[model samples]
Target: MKKEIGSEFWTVEQTAEKQHLFNAFKRNQRFFLSGRTALDFLIKNIKAKKPIRKAYLPSYCCHSMIQPFLDNDIEVIFYEVLIKENKLMIKVDPNVECDLFYTIQYFGFVDEQLDDFIRKIKQQGKLIVEDATHSLFTAKAFHTEADYVFASLRKWTGLPGGALVWSNETLYAPASKTDSNKAYIEKREAAYRLKRRYIEGEPIEKKAFLTLFDEAEQMLDKDYRGYGCGQEIQEQIEHLDIAKIKKNRQENAAFLCEKLRFCKDIELLYKAVKQDTCPVFVPIIVKKHQRDPLRAFLIQQNIYCPIHWPISPMHKLNVGTEALYKNTLSLVCDQRYEIEDMTSIVNAIIQFFERK
Candidate 1:
């Protein structure tokens, strides 16, 4: 039987032996229903302390990441991010005035240049918010200069509802309660359970769980208020074997990097997985015309790759940023798959390109 590669996480039995993952950054920490909710609360918390008129955000970003600032009535000024030598380079103008600066650790690779940029802007008394959603498992996930840090826990694990937000300073209570998001959480949890059964070769239709996932996502997109995380989800997070998960991801990413390093039709965003990096996905840039075709081919082979994002026209991105958005596709390198699974994906990709 062929195994599916990437999509929503299926439920897994919790290990009896549990471990704490965020002990280092537990101080001033608060949990929320999702990352966007965490971010909404963080923006409000910051605005409560100081008057924030505008925020500087990356041009290449998910709309969800930018929406919180807009919801809080803060103007968002975008900085250009370009791919140079297969690495993401962020361009921020130091002279430009903004109350808050947002930074992202893309695909778990820590950019030292971004750290320096944060330090410089911090000296100017700007509040820094680091989005560690992709880099949550990395050794250098948190930035020293960042006043606030937030990550979406669901991105890394099979959880119903979870996001973590904390500050170097004291944190304020979230405006909304988790009760408002109970329906969304229940739908997602049910979906995870159903997905697990399907994955284990049960005679279940794919649409059974997919429908639940879609409903859950729609609920989130429509109303991502400042809802706190459910107690059950928080408990689930506490019981996770974070170290094992991180190690698995790192090894899988390394194997893929070594195997697909010189593929003719695709270029890897990161050439190698570093000791400190825990990659969420092994991203590749394909030719604009062939990207969709390649993704479709991989799907036919039981590989489900995802585009990082389709750029929003609202951002009015630069030419380079637009091209990057059009061509980028994310390959699965998460904890769910092993080296053998990655080998299968690699062979399928090679087969697709060879046919060209």
Candidate 2:
């Protein structure tokens, strides 16, 4: 049978495992419509308590990440990031302090350098917010000294609408109750249909599933900051198997690296997994000329890959950011797939280059 490899998909049982995993990180976590929504809410609360004037963020990052601060009138200072030996090294001027310093566990690889960087920022008395969207499955997932941390739960799991914001201390109470709003109703319906088609051998068109999934996603795209996730979706998060999710992703990523290391047309952006690392996807820098063609080929084979992000109009003006944006592509290697799935992806990738 032909296979379709896409985003992470989960069943009732799986989402249950996720809830258990989430509880392990912190006793309290606030969920929102999306990561940006959660982030926007958190920033607003932080600003209310302290005068946050400027933010230092990596030069190469998602546009959504930049939106919250800019919308609130916080100055954004871009820092250089160096990629060497399959590691991302962030270069920030320790002396040039900002009210808030943001860092990412890029593709789940946070080495000693990143650890020291986080330490330095904390020691500097800067309010830190670590983006753990890519490293949600790691052991030390919420182990941060940062005042606030937020992650895009939908990125790593099958849930249609949810993001989480948590802190080390009981800074404030989360929305005590989840509501039964229209967005929640739509997401639950679509998710139910998609899960049935995915796991129960239901005869449904691929487009049918996608349309429902897209509809579910659109529900979360609205600016619903400070809103809590629905009870239905929250329950879905409870069943996710954190350990199994981490193990599968780590093994699959390793398999892809070992299989495709010889490809000259692409460079593995991250290769090694440290103890605290749990990759969400396999990232590679496709040769500029071959990038789009490779992406097209993968889609043709029903193996959809996505560019980490397309540069925003503002970021496109930056030389480094634009180059990184155009070159980076992420292959889905989440816990949803197994060895056979990865093997097929590898074969298709190799065939694409062989024919080129």
Candidate lDDT scores, in order, read 0.85, 0.73
The sequence of per-residue lDDT tens digits that candidate 2 reaches over residues 1-356 is 33678643644336322345566665456777678777887787787688999998888788888878888899888887655443455677866869998878777765456677777778889888878888777766644587788888778766666788887645454543345246654765676566566655666676676676667656644544456777777766766667778888888888888888888878888765555578888888777468788889989888888787767753423554456676778888877789899998999888998896
Candidate 2: which stretches are off by over 4 Å? 8-19, 22-28, 82-89, 173-181, 184-203, 215-219, 274-276, 314-317
lDDT for 249 (candidate 2): 84
Clashes of 2: 15
**Ten consecutive residues with minimal summed lDDT in candidate 2?**
10-19
Tell me the alpha-carbon RMSD of every candidate: 1.6, 3.0
For every model shown, what is its TM-score relative to the native structure? 0.96, 0.87
TM-score of 1: 0.96
The model with the greatest lDDT is 1
Off by over 4 Å in 1: 178-180
- Residue by residue across 113-150, what tens digits does model 1's lDDT show? 78778878999988999999999889998797889999
lDDT at position 66, candidate 1: 85
